[model samples]
Target: MSTEKVRAYQPETKPKRKQKQVKVKVTKKKWISTGEKYLYSVISGAMLCACAYVISFSSATDSLNRDIESMEGKIQEQQSVNNSLSYEAEQLRNPERILEIAKKHGLDIKQSQVKQAGTVSAD
Candidate 1:
């Protein structure tokens, strides 16, 4: 009974093995990868080009509108000049004015038959 009690109280005779220290490699993650950076750059460049195109198109449209307005003004001025010239031509074609001019040119006409010219249209 004494031997059984001493053996029960004795520790195990097995050699203790040392625990292996595992080295964990802690790698810091990059905020942006190389591929992501290139994609972002391409997108930004495309946006910039699009903005430039829109601005240039707007400027060209404004210039075209200005030119059109200037042409319209010129056309109106020309129309006014044509109207005055047409009025002067009608005054010159008056029958009374023609008779006065013919008399001043020493044209002796016993018959005061003044025929008005008319436009002949082929209908």
Candidate 2:
């Protein structure tokens, strides 16, 4: 048997702080539930869908209005063309103008070359 020396355990003493110690703040962390997270995701998805619907509706309204404006412009243009054509027709119907144009085209307008039509009444 060998001779051995055993050491005794000693506790360390704490040092005294003179000034008031600042309290260390411990923040509590809140954890979200899986169900709550899923609910939030569903709500967000529904809101996104509603917003997209509104945006598409507004876009369609704008497109329709633009098409209507373009059609109105075309209608106005056609009306102007119609008015010009009517004016030209009235100008062409002048007897003096007709005679002048006929003379220029070497067309004869003798009274014997015209024929009278018989009048018929619809019953």
Candidate 3:
């Protein structure tokens, strides 16, 4: 039994592995040759350009809106000025005001002077 146990218990030996130097081959890639990569770059550039154009257009639209608002305000102000000027013109066209202005300008018309001026004088 001891001999059978000794024969069954043969010492274990580890297998030796050989180490070799491995060379890895790396390939150089051209900038335009890879289809998917080039396509991705082109699509990305197009997306960026589209975004920039949208941003610029939005900014221009905002500027135009602001200008429109400014013009509207100016138009309102001008309308108010025109209303006041029209009121002033109506007041100036009043006969009493015209008489006062003529008096201030040293132009006086007596009733006799009007009648004398109305009569035609034959020379």
Candidate 4:
């Protein structure tokens, strides 16, 4: 029951090389139904919400990906440090190197004082 309507075309006519002007009127279809208008508004709102969600999701995903890369780099660095420390530990545990350093300090190992490992006496 809406009285409002839209004009399809309006024309302005003027006499060629003369003093005359005319206005022409054209009538078009009337306004759409209330249900159609409501449908249009609802569709527009839904589209807007969908676009906003996509934008927010993409930005958040990008930030999380950056954090993952940073953490991976830190893990690699720590693993490298751990490997270096392991190598140093290996060098320190060498028996020949330990004995060489002990000799420098004038420490001697007597053979009789050395007990065979895991040897058991029945007594």
Candidate 5:
């Protein structure tokens, strides 16, 4: 057996230090959630597309109307030209005018042989 010293058990104590108080800042919460924000964005985009479609349709309709009006104006002008040409042709086909032109050309045509030709009707 070896000779050994036996130590007594004693409790250790430490000095207390002052602790500083930590402040926690509270953040404000957003009224709209992320999911709600995405839903609103999709809805607004759809509405915008709908509005654009309506406006474009209206513009196309207006353009077609203008084109129709232009064609109508052209038809009216052509009808006026046709009317004037028909009147001039009628003037040229007059019996007196034909006789005068024949006389000017030194053709001695008898009045009895100068029969006035009438128009043939299909009906």
Candidate 6:
């Protein structure tokens, strides 16, 4: 019987490679056209005018509400004065009030004898 010799095989290793760096150039771009620029300015001006109009409208509405409230207060005051005047008018129409006024003015109330009053008064 003959013995054969065995050879061990070694694993292969890969070589390391160097990485290359890339350079990028950045450039500025003009994205607006002349016609678009004019349109944008017009739109901005219109927006500003609209905002001003809204503010003015709100102020006017607030002023109108204040005026309405003031007018209502005046109407209430006038109604109270009218009621007071009406009560005074009613008091003036009373018989006691009329007698008091007559007494204050020094007018006299008279009583007469029946036969003498009848003889004297027809003319």
Best by TM-score: 1
Model 2 over residues 40-80: C-alpha lDDT tens digits?
Answer: 99999999999999999999999999999999999999999
- By summed lDDT, the worst window of 10 consecutive residues in model 3 runs over 111-120
> What's the distance in Å from true for residue 3, model 4?
50
Candidate 4 off by > 4 Å: 1-28, 112-123
Identify the superior model by lDDT, candidate 2 or candidate 6: 2
What is the C-alpha local distance difference test score of candidate 6?
0.79
The lDDT values for all models are: 0.95, 0.82, 0.83, 0.82, 0.88, 0.79
Q: Kindly list the per-residue Cα lDDT of model 6 for residues 10-74, writing each as its tens digit.
A: 34467868879789898777699789999999999999999999999999999999999999999
Which regions of candidate 3 fall more than 4 Å away from where they truly are?
Answer: 1-33, 100-123
Residue 1's lDDT in candidate 6: 28
Kindly list the per-residue Cα lDDT of model 4 for residues 1-123, writing each as its tens digit: 233332324354565786577888887866997899999999999999999999999999999999999999999999999999999988977777777787899999765343333566788
- What is the C-alpha RMSD, rounded to one decimal, of candidate 5? 11.3
lDDT of 2 at 51: 100
User: What is the C-alpha lDDT profile of model 5 across 1-123, one tens digit per residue?
Assistant: 233322233344577798998999999899999999999999999999999999999999999999999999999999999999999999998888998999899988765566666878788
Q: Which ten residues in a row have the lowest lDDT in candidate 1?
A: 108-117
Prediction RMSDs, each to the true structure: 9.8, 11.5, 8.2, 16.9, 11.3, 12.7
Tens digit of lDDT per residue, candidate 1, span 1-123? 799899999997998799999999999999999999999999999999999999999999999999999999999999999999999999999999999998899987788689877886788
Candidate 4 least-lDDT 10 residues: 1-10
Candidate 1 lDDT: 0.95
User: Which ten residues in a row are the worst by lDDT in model 2?
Assistant: 1-10
List ranges where model 1 is wrong by over 4 Å.
1-24, 117-123
Output the worst ten-in-a-row residue range by lDDT, candidate 6. Answer: 111-120
| Candidate 5 TM-score over all chains jointly | 0.63
lDDT string, candidate 3, 4-115, tens digits: 8997898867797887979999998776667888799999999999999999999999999999999999999999999999999778667766667778999876753322
Error of 2 at 74 (Å): 1.6
Ranking by lDDT: 1, 5, 3, 2, 4, 6
TM-score of each: 0.70, 0.53, 0.58, 0.63, 0.63, 0.56
Q: Report clashes for each candidate as comma-separated counts.
A: 0, 0, 0, 0, 0, 0
Q: Which candidate has the top score in lDDT?
A: 1
